[model samples]
Target: MDFFNDHKKLFSSALAFFLCLTLVICILPALDNQRVIQPLPNAKHLTAQETRGKLIYIREGCVACHTQQVRNIDMDQVFGSRPSLSADYALNKRMSFLQNTATLMGSERTGPDLTNIGARQPSKEWQFTHLYNPRAVVPASIMPSFKWMFIEKEQLGPNDIEVSVPDEFKKGVKGKIVASQDAKDLVAYLLSLKQVELPSNIPVREFLYKSEKKEAANSGKGGNLPDGAALYTANCVACHQASGEGLPGAFPPLKGSSVVLGDDLELYITIIMKGYNARVPEYGVMPPVGTTANFKPEEVAAIMNHERTSWGNNAKEVTAEEVKAIMDKIK
Candidate 1:
């Protein structure tokens, strides 16, 4: 009773109690988790440029709209190869003594999930153009342009990188849109957001409540052929676009491409599997989409067929057998 009457003693007792609770409930568990969990075996640490870009990303408040998480739901399948695991965040270190590392698992998804954006859209040119003016690449995009990341230069130096801005989105006052160092760093960071492959021993969690429509498509019930349009939308639409007309001066247009319409099936397959750099000065290097995604012969045929048929470019349809034969020869 005397101790309670002493306000300082009572306050000190209460403070000690709360501190004990915090240690038991918060700090202890966090330390235990850190000890038990480890980063994926193949996970790479951020490079100096990527780290700078990450800081810029934080400064730009990108975490406000985009999320770095992929929930274990069928809908989230588009964002990553598999559901995100606790180990995915185990490598995150504190920014400083005062600042905790941001997982960037944002509540609101005002934009698409960026868990695997690096793999989905790897082209630096596309990234630069998109950042300078979102509408330049995606006409229907609601995302605000971060044109401040770039500068208009009358003449570019030997090492300077330029963004290809279309006339419609230029909004007047034009010179070459040169990427600042920060912009390059930011793109580098964004391009490093690839999801690593889980080890073979680890059991993967399946996406829950998958739709019957998707199940039916995956089952190959109809003629045993995969959906070309779906494959294109998932793999190619980001750069080539739904209309098949790629962004001018960034991604090459597939609408009337001679390779797409040409009789040279082998060349087309090679480009898809091995990738193309012949038009580097005019266009960004096309990544080896087939190789990276481990695309099957059927999958490649589906994509090729989709490109050849879509956007009013009629050409001979390819079979999985033809694609497989070419892929084997190329390898």
Candidate 2:
């Protein structure tokens, strides 16, 4: 009995030492896990509205019906170059990326991958309409409507607005109808879900092209601004759109872009001539726009002039003759 009592103190001390050691090891790593979770250097946290929508997405049990990750064999190469990582969001500890992964312990895909669900369909109005009434956009959408997120249209600015927006939308909106702030935030999160490798290399240059040769060729065909704007609205607006905003990330925006208004007018001429189908890219490429293409050289010049000047952009005017000169090179 005396020996047993003496041994009890030693055993208790040993247990306490082991527990403290384990706590030290676990706590230290947890406090610093943010460093490991971040894939991008200095990646920012989700914006306020996106963070709110994330909560809504979780509360609605959307996770029960959808998956936010992709696998290599899933054949979603256009979704981007590869699958996602917890490090992609710096979210490894906040919630296990594995927890959000909805898959069949048995097997099922009742809903589509909501991984990059932001612009999976463009039009912000489409999201609102789909949420308010799914059957309106897709007769087959079985996902229940989230009418709770909507309200009737509200008045925007008093003096500047050309058209009255729905009570739901804010100024400078892009959707088909009205939109909620949460919708904008959710779209931001979705667009930010780009898991593709950031392109690190710039396109290699050969030689700069001068417009002098083309200008000499088009010596008599110079056209002005209004003609170009009219031509653009008539011919180019169907796909590229009236505002040049493009279809979000689906079609590239012409506003504030270098490639569209750049010095290489010849490159523009070739694409317009060929009509764009760059071999199975993510968003569908262009169909032929003229009789065999989108427009005549004069029309193309007018549209280019409109784009380079509109969207608060001020640049050199493109003339019909200039476009014709480039067209001749391509033909």
Candidate 3:
């Protein structure tokens, strides 16, 4: 009772108690975690360009809409091959003495998780185009255009990198769109966000709460074919619109393309696996989606059938066996 009456003594005691609690409950646990968790062996540090890009990423508040984390759930499986572990973020270093490091594991997911975006979409051309105008690549995207990151040049410099933007999304600019140093740095950082493979000795964690419907589809149970429409939506729908009409002068249309309707299965399979880059300055280089996603024979067949039959293009549907044979030879 006397001690409570002494205001200074009481305040000091309270402060001491709070510090003790913080030490036991927060600091101790964090220190223990630091000791136990180690970065993955294959994880690489960010390059100079990538570090600059990361600062730009923070400056632009990209973490507001996009997250770098992949939670341990079936829904998050699309973002990464496996559930995220503490080791995935162990290699992250502080930006500087004044600025502390952030995990960038954002709370909201207005856009897709970028935990494995590097492996998923590695094409620099596509990244530049998408950044300049999201609607140019994804017609239904709600993302705001980062047009300021690009420069409109009447004539390109010798070392200038050009971005092929669709006329409709150009906002009436006649000049060629070229990526700025900031844009290049930002894309470099984005491209470095890949999930490294875990060591063989450690047991891989499984994504929990997988729905029976998804399980059945994945296992191809009951003689059912893989869902072509879903596969296309996941992989192809971003660049090629839902109507199969891609942006002109940016991405080639697949509505009535000879490649889709042609009888050349070998050529089609090769393009999907290895990707096509010869159409540069006209269309952005296509990323190796099939290879990145690790598409199975059945999955490839399903996608081929979907593209061939839809958009009023009635080409011959491919079989899993045919696709597998081609894949084997190509590989």
Clashes of each: 0, 10, 0
TM-score of 2: 0.43
Candidate 1 clashing pairs, residues 3+ apart or interchain: none
Query: What are the runs in model 1 whose C-alpha is more than 4 Å off?
Result: 214-223, 280-282
lDDT measured at residue 261 in model 2 versus the true structure, 0 to 100: 74
**Model 2 stretches with alpha carbons more than 4 Å out:** 1-33, 41-44, 75-79, 91-109, 153-188, 199-331
TM-score of 3: 0.89
Best by lDDT: 3
How far residue 82's Cα lies from its native spot in candidate 1, in Å, is 0.9
Which pairs clash (backbone N, Cα, C closer than 3 Å) in model 3?
Answer: none
lDDT value, residue 46 of candidate 3: 90
On lDDT, who's better, 1 or 2?
Answer: 1
Over 1-331, each residue of candidate 3 has an lDDT whose tens digit, in order, gives: 9999999999999999999999999999988998999999999989999999999999999999999989989999899999899999998877888887558888899999999998877778778989998878876789998999999999999878899788777777978999999999999999999999999998899999997765224322213458888888878877777889987878788899999999999999988888888556778888788997789988888888889989999977778888899999999
Instruction: Note the Cα lDDT for every prediction shown.
Output: 0.85, 0.52, 0.87
The 10-residue segment with the lowest total lDDT in model 3:
215-224
Higher TM-score: candidate 1 or 3?
1
